[model samples]
Target chain A: MNGPIIDITDLSKFYGKARGIEHINLEIGEGEIFGFIGPNGAGKSTTIRILMNMIFPTGGSARIMGMDVIRDTKKIKTQVGYIPSDASAYSSMDVHEFLSYCIRFYQIQNGEQRISDLSELFELDLNRQIADLSLGNRKKVSIVQSLLHNPKLLILDEPTTGLDPLMQSVFFDLLRSENKNGMTIFFSSHILSEVQMLCKRVAIIKEGKIIQLEDIDNMRKKQLKKVSVELADHVNIKSFSIHGIENVITGPGNMLSFMYSGNINDLVGFLSGKEIINLMIEEPSLDEIFLHYYRS
Target chain B: MNKNLFLKEIRRNSVSLMIWMIVITLLIVVTMSFYRTFLENQSKIVGMLSLIPKGALQFKGISNFNDLMSVLGFYAANNVIYMMVLGSIFSIVLSSNILLKEEYDKTAEYLLTRPVTRSEIFISKLAVLSINVFILNLVTALAGFICMELVMKTPFSIGAFLILSIYTLLLNILFGAIGLFLSTLIKRAKPITTFSIGLVLIFYFIYTLSKITEGAAKMGYLSPFRFASVDATNPAYTIDLWHLAYFIGISLFLTGLSYRLYKRKDIYT
Candidate 1:
């Protein structure tokens, strides 16, 4: 119980000769939101499926709550709540009926109350058949079903793919509340902002391999920030190098933009002495961070 | 654990149950009515009826109709062959829906995430199909007996009826297993259904071909339908113990194989 809730060690999966995931190792602690960031076909979902025990790993092992995933899949599944990227329910069943069916499979008490709460939270209509609901609404139903059992661990793949902005915030709030109650959440998202906001630590994946796994704050500190200064007239761009800046770009001899990867104070003093009209500083987006990591 | 899941399956397949019931009842009524009219010409009909093979006559389980209409009425009643076919078709219809529905609705991922193991889920669904098949055969047998009584006024030995019912149930299990096996192999519902129907037709045709050709008679052994005695005159209307054993054995084997394959196969698109 003192160890991480999820421990994946040297995990690998292959589809025929092609590698699905390779030498993947990570640990997610209780009460932590671990973001798995990757683009399409980056093995994010594959790793999650292995954790969920939907399939076995080709090499290595994964343990959840001190239980081997493959050996104790039944015990593991009961304690984990999973929201698949393309969640679907029986088309013939209405929302309430579908939830009722799922509830019978678990040992949860007071399932009715949980279902009611989730319906209210997601603003889902209980009477509508699943086929009648829109894609986003179906995703909401999936979320509700996964949460209804009050699982100890949550594995969600692309959890916010189909949600509007307001609903996405609601989902994040729900996840935050669960994390506060000591649930371990391991989610994959292409949305960097969501990961930045929800997760304390993240693992960036590319082409079936982990490119980087670090604390969010540390990642932000390590990644470069861009600073752009609108110049009054053409001047020597090399002067910007005084701030320990690199990759400077001058457009039409009036604008100077360069990537800053060092201390902010150096740039502040260097800019204070220049004849600048306006200055803007912003951090690089998640894509840029991933791109940089990927390139390296 | 299995009992509750079995009941749920019966509820899901109630539509098919009702249809089979209606068809079996109508067959009983029509056959009895026709036999009654034929019996009116007693001299001509009795001679012709006697000439028919005893096995074929026993297959219908109809004897001298005290109420001629009633005797003929149950002629179609004990047609266990027809009942078995209906049971097999229903089994396929119900079992084929098991996996494909989850995949079609995109609920496999959600269902797989539950605390239950893949083997447990597979077995649960198989258990449901088995129970449904058993109930279906039981209902058909009981209803057929009742129709026979209403039409013929003749009583049947409970033992003989029970044996026949057991045979039909075994036949259902065999076909249901085939359906379940196909569900795992195929990803779509339509192909599985069509292939199941094709299998039924092929087995039936093989059974008939065995009867017509000298070397082909053994071919009947290959069909689950052939294991159940459609002709009651041979006193072998009861299912052969070996055949019953084989049916159950194959069913379990196929189900186990499917579970193993599904456990390792990659699911995500």
Candidate 2:
């Protein structure tokens, strides 16, 4: 309540000789949509699992709302909502039964009303058996269950995996509304675009370590771009070297490609004298950004 | 223990408990039904039984032919396999899966994420295991009682019958503890059903082998079944203090150890 809503310090987890997350530290403020992005096996889920206390960290500490994640797990969980990466629930239980069971874990009044409201929003049939539901429907049931208690903090791990694009829109809208109501969100995913679309601040993880932590605006305004030009005449590759030019490479024929993180006008002015036959400038993929960070 | 988790686990295990109860009760009833035929041809049956090896008779837990003549002895010898071995199997299987199933089924993420501690989860599932084992034993013991009453030519000692039933219950509970301990030690989430059931059978086999082989009689001490006295016809038969301590002590030790291990276990799903 006083400092960050979630604070992780020098946290590390190891499974025998394999690394889970190593000496990682993070802080998420209240009422903020925080994104944790990483590729598969990059320890995104490992960090989240430690925060949720689903697994113990081999070292370091984590706290939620100023309480220890391990020692005060029950107290912390009362106000924390989590949607796991997997949409697996008890297959033997019907959707309504599973939702009801989950709601009883808290002392919330009007539990049925909340379940119905969330289920309706997700277009979930409460009576359908979980085993009978498609993967998408099961994910819907999972989403509805996480929101039934109206938690103060919501932690999602690849929460939109099986949902259709339309459903994903609804889910994101609901998340935005929840955040507006002062609920903090920790959204973890491999999809950078989705993280870009929702998160205010983000931490990019790779090889079990945090590689970058920055405001989403700063990340976007860093001025990284993919530029490719096919010259009408063969030009010296050395001439393409400008202030922001990086990873410059020559292709078949007279094509020159590189990444630019400098002023746009400077790149245009430099390329003007080259007699370019074709030019393409687009946003770099997340992988390229990640590679750049790793290389640098 | 959390009430919500306790109630849900009870509901989840009710069907399996009912099926086990029915199967054991039916086995007891069918076995007890043969009592009248055995009584009618007592001499011929005794002579035929005499021709069987002494070791084989001891394996069936028949110390003497006269023990078989008594209805309670007949039931105890025959039904130990059902109520002790099978019931222990059921108890171990139920206990082993109650917590681990949440992991293997991938529902632990949902359950463990709730406002409940790992201790509460372990205690809740243990409560369900204890209650289920109790209910199964009570139901089948009652069925055994009824079958014995219907077939008994003479009144048997009530105290001896009760002691026998307690032994069976203790044996079942010990297996339940073993299962819980085994489950906690598993680093990965997978059903130990076959391994749990096999442990019970292997213990029973040890008990049987110990009974028949003179040189191996001491080996039965390694099995929990050896501590459970099934001789229902002994006039002084009562619950043994050491056996009671063995069952209660080992169960509590295992259950406590499991709770500690589970509290710190890195549940992976």
Q: Give the alpha carbon lDDT tens digit for every residue of B150-263 in model 1.
A: 654455555556776777787788888788777777633243667787788788777756655657768777877767654333234455779778888998898788888777
Q: Which candidate gets the maximum lDDT versus the true structure? A: 2
Every candidate's CA RMSD:
5.1, 1.9
TM-scores for every predicted model:
0.82, 0.96
Model 1 Cα RMSD, 1 decimal? 5.1
What are the per-residue Cα lDDT tens digits for candidate 2 across A33-80?
Answer: 999998899999999999999899999999999999999999999999
lDDT of 1 at B256: 82
CA lDDT scores, all candidates in order: 0.75, 0.91
Best candidate, DockQ-wise? 2
Proportion of true contacts reproduced by candidate 2: 0.92
Clashing pairs in 1: A78-B115, B32-B72, B32-B73, B70-B151, B70-B152
